[model samples]
Target: MTGLVAAQGRPVGTMGRMASTAPLPLTVGFDLDMTLIDSRSGIAATYRALSAGTGVPIDDALVVTRIGPPLETELAHWFPAEEVPAAADRYRALYPSHAIAPSTALAGARESVAAVRALGGRAIVVTAKHEPSAELHLAHLGIEPDTVIGRLWAEAKGEALREHAAQVYVGDHVGDVRGARAAGAVSVAVTTGPCDAQELREAGADVVLADLTGFPAWLRAFEAARAA
Candidate 1:
């Protein structure tokens, strides 16, 4: 069991959900990459570009499959520890060119963010991508979140969620579940990414939905039940 401090002094039990009884605002946090956008093509292209420039052969297909983690982490798998930093820098330099056109918001992504706003809640994005890159994706997709915190993965995401006092965190990766749980927020997993429903369930997601399309109704019902 991974231990994490509760957000805003709220009690977070073993379930990793906030145990507070006070009426809290419906703040929601989201993961970018596979959760909101299909960035595989762009990511793969960038890796290929890096390989071409550095004369290092890279398996773009394998790289694309491991997108949820940080670019450095992925680079480390291929490059030596000493070479990772430079390789990562090269990758970031090549990313924007390859990313812009091919990257697109996944279905129901906008609606999910809109749902949070509609419920008088603030929507934020926490991602492993660089902050500027994450911002570019949001701008390109025309989806607005109250805040975007990038370059944070796993437990590091917990600190940001705590600062925002998020009640719900939605994502498509198991890392997202761990992050949400660490922050004591509801971990809502969507099976639109590489991970299937059962995989997400085993990862300890509180609620597993087919995709973000189901989130609005689920949130509504959850709020109604809480009120009742």
Candidate 2:
């Protein structure tokens, strides 16, 4: 049996809004970084560029390790409280030129989104990164989700997910679990990012996947059950 269960522990009908009357289109939320885009190298390069331009000492390797949180959160570690705002702005400005080219789409990223559409569902990307920068990355990599929401993270990400009526939220962080929980959506976590499987489970993820490669199978099983 596939372990794709709903929030209340039901194996079938993962969506809280599913109706036995008729099958309706579904919306699935995904995290941008780590889950959809392997932006670690690009992000690191951007940080390095920011450091060079700002004359600040930033550890690109170290920053890339904890990649799920917001940019300002990490900037705080390297910049003074007063300088964080400016540094964040500068980083965002440098990101396009320094980060976009090197960033690559994670394996199965395109197929995962297409899988949603193949089932008459909408795939959306929710992220903490700035909206413009997020759009640039997606444009650069040719990864097109139906909707892309930016500047949201962790529990705060629930705002956009709820608005889109997303029944599932896929991501690579414990914060993402909280976001899905906040929106009453099933949390499907991928192990491609900093968080490990155990950590994701401990954080209350409903499903733990090795990477996006397994998403289509999971989505297939999920829809099959919903239509059952």
Candidate 3:
């Protein structure tokens, strides 16, 4: 099971979803992409499709390694700055059909979400992927988050979290951490994205975990800490 030390020094992970022995105080949120699903396969396939259309052969390894962040940002990395916009558009056009369903949720992701909902917490998914595109991804992956807000500007996530009344959020990227902090949500970092532990720590995540397999217990602990 994944492990994370809560603010109150409680070791959480195994059986973490148990109701907080203490009073609780916060809503929960989640990020998509690497946080909920392993998007590498779909993302890589989308890029591959784009490459085929543009007649540019890209190394699948190189493409798969950079799957987080906004699609536009990825386009910039894969193509020249000037061509990024067009390339990104093309990528998005083919992505839904080619990548969404093929992308599978990460291990233990759905179970953790269910645990959150069972605990009377409202779980929301806030992502930078375009709304229509994100919907496709969710549908393809057979996931239906409580509420999904997508196609947000990188910085807009914080504001969205605030609007959603999220008190804590789980994510796997620096941007996710920033958005959660900006919205005054406790940032729980998961090492499922391109970022490493050191990088996430440097980004000031409140808690870090290897993955969501052990999130229920942490959520319970978090609720308890909030109540206190």
List runs of model 1 lying over 4 Å from the truth: 1-22
lDDT of each: 0.88, 0.91, 0.80
Could you estimate the TM-score for every candidate?
A: 0.89, 0.90, 0.83
Q: Which ten residues in a row have the lowest lDDT in candidate 3?
A: 14-23
Who wins the TM-score comparison? 2
lDDT of 3 by residue, 1-228 (tens): 457877776676533655545434356778888899887887888778888899877776786775657777767766889898888788778977888777888877888788778778777888888778877777776776778888664457889889978888888888888888898888899998888888888987999999998788888887766766
Q: In model 2, which regions exceed 4 Å deviation?
A: 1-24
Q: What lDDT, from 0 to 1, does candidate 1 have?
A: 0.88
Candidates ranked by lDDT:
2, 1, 3
What is candidate 2's CA lDDT for residue 72? 91
Write the residue-wise lDDT of candidate 2 on 1-228 in tens digits. 677886677766545445457655688999989999999999999998988898888999999999989999999999989999999888988888989999999998999999999999999999998989888999998888888899898889999999999989999999999999999998999999999999999999999999999999999999899788
lDDT of 3: 0.80
Clashes of 3: 4
**TM-score, candidate number 1:** 0.89
* CA displacement after TM-score superposition, residue 228 of candidate 1 (Å): 3.5
